[model samples]
Target: MIRQRITATTDPAAVHPGLAEHQSDMIRRCPYLGPSVDRGLTVWSAYDAEPGDQPGLFALLVETAEELRTARRESGPLACRNIAILDPEDSESARKIMQWPAWLARNLYAPVQLMVGRFWTGVELDDSKGRAMMPPPVSFFSLRNAIPSKDGLFLSEKLPEIMAILEQGPGDDGRDVFAEPLGRRVDDPASVYRELKGLFPPPSLATAG
Candidate 1:
């Protein structure tokens, strides 16, 4: 099971800029239903952050969903700005960098859909498709690459291939399949692999074959 560690409940006026004045009252009156469905945004600590310096990064995974009809209809990368929360030049800075097109799309055109990666959420999905969709945790080292778009990000990679498979209907069939437990953020990949092996002992040769 997965558990949420944080919640946002501030007035729309105080946080979200898109909420209109008329909607503010309605949003306020509406019960605080909690963060928007735990869309895979989480606090991630760097492998070597010092004590008390936990949660070194704020990660938001964009995942393909059935509800993303407009995104599904599109053939290429959906444009969006990579909002760097920190300085862009610094290696450790959290600044999100959006290429000219993505910046323009977010600032000039309508907002596009982004998908969330389920592996990082620490919640296991019950079905094979959902499980197959999980990517190697190391892949997140390039967080921006997971963002699928045709527009091309300034310095980010788009994930159209990953998205296409995930978007398939439940009854759909294909050669695409994968099986691996979600991995943890650690100092090295070898250590993580070792830990996973212990949790999931290798199947016998007959079973594996």
Candidate 2:
């Protein structure tokens, strides 16, 4: 499985190196995610100013690329999973909040699989504005019990379908799932910058230095 975490820190190059090393060591010690595979999971860290913009919130990105490669070498059907760990300090609703408009427009649609963890249970968002107003820690633990069993169709069947939706490439159906305005056109960087400036003003000159 590919498991990852998302963070909102400004400097991933500095923070990720240490965190990745620690996580790698942890995975090496883990019984389930370790022995089943050779080498270890690939780890990557990325930063986005708009999403979960806070330091100390770490995201781990894990992929099954190596396992897939090994499976092909052994002439076996690919069997792996991708999982992303979202820090509770980071908001889940905020992750895809921008996609809400396109989802409503029917220009694009996709399912996101979430492993209910301590982070999910504490989610408290205002239904009216879709804003998270409170921090709920227990919400994460509740998800542990709610997750579908590994033997069930939920993970095998539903997960693949959801992945397909997420895999839709850019320009498919004149839509970019990762696009800020969802289905709308603002393809060029200049246009994107202009749009973003309206929503988020440029950092003051005093703060720039």
Candidate 3:
């Protein structure tokens, strides 16, 4: 199974020097996320209009080229409509937000404000030369909505409410927050994001005519 590696940075030049001049080579050298092998490069970068400040960026290295193609096919017209142009600043933001428990804590309270992101994907070579040096192409989608956001409450105020809610039982309000059957709740990494952040419901699959 392939997974994406997300990172955040305040400075891209420091992290990956000469990024502007050597986009492809430099990007390929970015640290490998883990045991999972990434197939294609899909990147998104979001920027703020305020000067002297950096834009938040995110990069998504998907599982396989074939898998990415399948994703586009499933996307239908969405693939054409949703694309973005990525820059260094945007890369840094993505790296920062992925910093583990701290990110969870911060986002649980006040959600960070963000604009729609520009999307990108790698373009595999079409010739017999193979995919030695592929170019990244820009595309757009409303993927920003899929990203989790802050819930607009101070940490101090939110913790107690969350704790209290966790303690409640079906007897309290006739609603079972823990109603899933034991077997049904077994470890599902696929739903982990939904479990953790509770945002960005899965895309709606199109129905056959």
Candidate 4:
């Protein structure tokens, strides 16, 4: 079984940014285009930060949360941003994350997969497809690739592949996505994972199937 706990709330401004405060905004909040069905944008931090009054990166996550109001309105495809924090314990990942800013500073065409990774959110299936299908909410996946549309974020090595899967429907999503988990199971920070519940995509093909 997985262990989970929520230590209470803290002010957003004071929580440590975790990343060096040099590049980009340490904290960010985008207005909800419309009503939220409970879960809005989920920002995940690795084991290093816990969401509680003690003060850590999660305080910034809490501040990012917005009040869910109003009924849903029909809208076009969403283009939300994904900013995932790496587990400080993984030295390799940590080094890469730290180097990302410097890499971009010199050459805007920096490879994004080397540093930042976004968790799987889920597939969007309209009414005919049976609403939206998702995995157990307590999932934080590692997505490798660059966000082509943003700034100098040209589509790097892994993104075009990822985009193909994203654009394709489930049955046609390709065999790569159906493969088993890439690495050993890493238990996500249960408390925060729970907080962002019901918002993750299926982890494997079996579940997605």
Candidate 5:
């Protein structure tokens, strides 16, 4: 799952200047303006989860935005600036990037499938319609394409090492590691795979002639 955080200026003037102009351009290009525009900066983030669990991400985004809005109302308008918390390749840098985005979209928007391949390599969709719908020249991550490690700790290529870090027992850190609770005990990869199969069933076999 890739997480994104977006921040933008509270001042109306500082909001994306070209956005209003683009609105007119879009109207000219397509007469259908499906929704009313509310002027605010919005941040977003996403995670990989079963389709059933997407509501939680949306809820989190909404709650964060409401909290920030309430804080600004009570204290005063915030300083004009935008910051995004992105995954840093290193531990120390990652910690520094943990701050929340101010305004967030209520909708839990997934990456426009065009961008999904950039992070998720070897991803195969079960549906033919889905494969056909994908944007052309799909980009993906590879060891050769990865950004160089600043800390000289090249764990990115080490899946076992990464998994170990992920599976570290609780009380080590409060950070939510698993998106959903696991039913099977740790070290049980087969059980995990079985559970996943239940959640994400294989495409049915084609009928024999």
Candidate 6:
């Protein structure tokens, strides 16, 4: 768990070097999370912010990407995963969290995948693209009131699972099982983001109707 602790940060740059430059395009692609993701692409109090789970989540994924980067260096090529973690529909507070997949891609430049019933576990660590990549399993460890600051999002209980996955790396025997009852696979976060924006629409627009 040292990785999780030490890696934890409220900074966007800490996760990836390209964060700032691509942030605008990312926001444009996933405008639903535009304001939240556009917190200037700098460090901030992600843990304490309301709906506050953004930064911490960023940190974890940042570390995960680092691990994959390392694996790629050591092992020839790497596949990336692009997964989305949809918040429970009833949860207005957690709703925006769903856009995180797009934000992560903009920053990490990796694909994300989701394993249904697994909360939001999605990934794409594969060699299909002939590049070093990892399965995009977006595991969403549920936190009933997990609003980032609530600290519920970072419960110790789920650390082991995350750590285990980190240790397993990509293309493991246990992956298929872990990915049981798969949900959606988001190849194009931008298009998906636009589609979602239309399907869900803004609260302001919904009310006007």
By TM-score, who's the top model here?
4
lDDT of 2 at 111: 21
Candidate structures ordered by TM-score, highest first: 4, 6, 2, 1, 5, 3
For model 5, the superposed segments whose C-alpha errors exceed 4 Å read 9-53, 75-209
Q: What do the candidate models score in CA lDDT, each in turn?
A: 0.24, 0.29, 0.26, 0.24, 0.25, 0.30
Which candidate order results from sorting by lDDT in descending order? 6, 2, 3, 5, 4, 1
- Model 3 lowest lDDT segment of ten: 53-62
- Badly placed stretches (over 4 Å) of model 3 are 1-19, 26-45, 48-71, 74-95, 100-209
Candidate 1 off by > 4 Å: 1-6, 16-92, 96-114, 117-157, 169-209
Give one digit per residue, the lDDT tens place, for model 1 in 25-79.
3223322212221322211211222122112221121111222323334422321
TM-score of 3: 0.19
Better of 3 and 4 by lDDT: 3
Clashes of each: 13, 22, 18, 1, 0, 43
TM-score of each: 0.23, 0.25, 0.19, 0.27, 0.20, 0.26
Give the per-residue lDDT of model 6 (tens digit) for 1-209: 11121233334344333333433433344333254433322122111122444544444444444444443344422222222233322334333453453233221221122111112222332222234333222223211101122222332243333323333334322222212222455333333433333433332212221
Instruction: Give the Å error, residue 95, model 3.
Output: 4.1
User: What is candidate 5's local distance difference test score?
Assistant: 0.25
Better of 1 and 6 by lDDT: 6
Q: Estimate the TM-score for candidate 5.
A: 0.20
Please estimate how well model 2 matches the true structure, expressed as its whole-model Cα lDDT. 0.29
Give residue 207's lDDT in candidate 2 (0 to 100). 14
Candidate 5 displacement at residue 20 in angstroms: 4.2
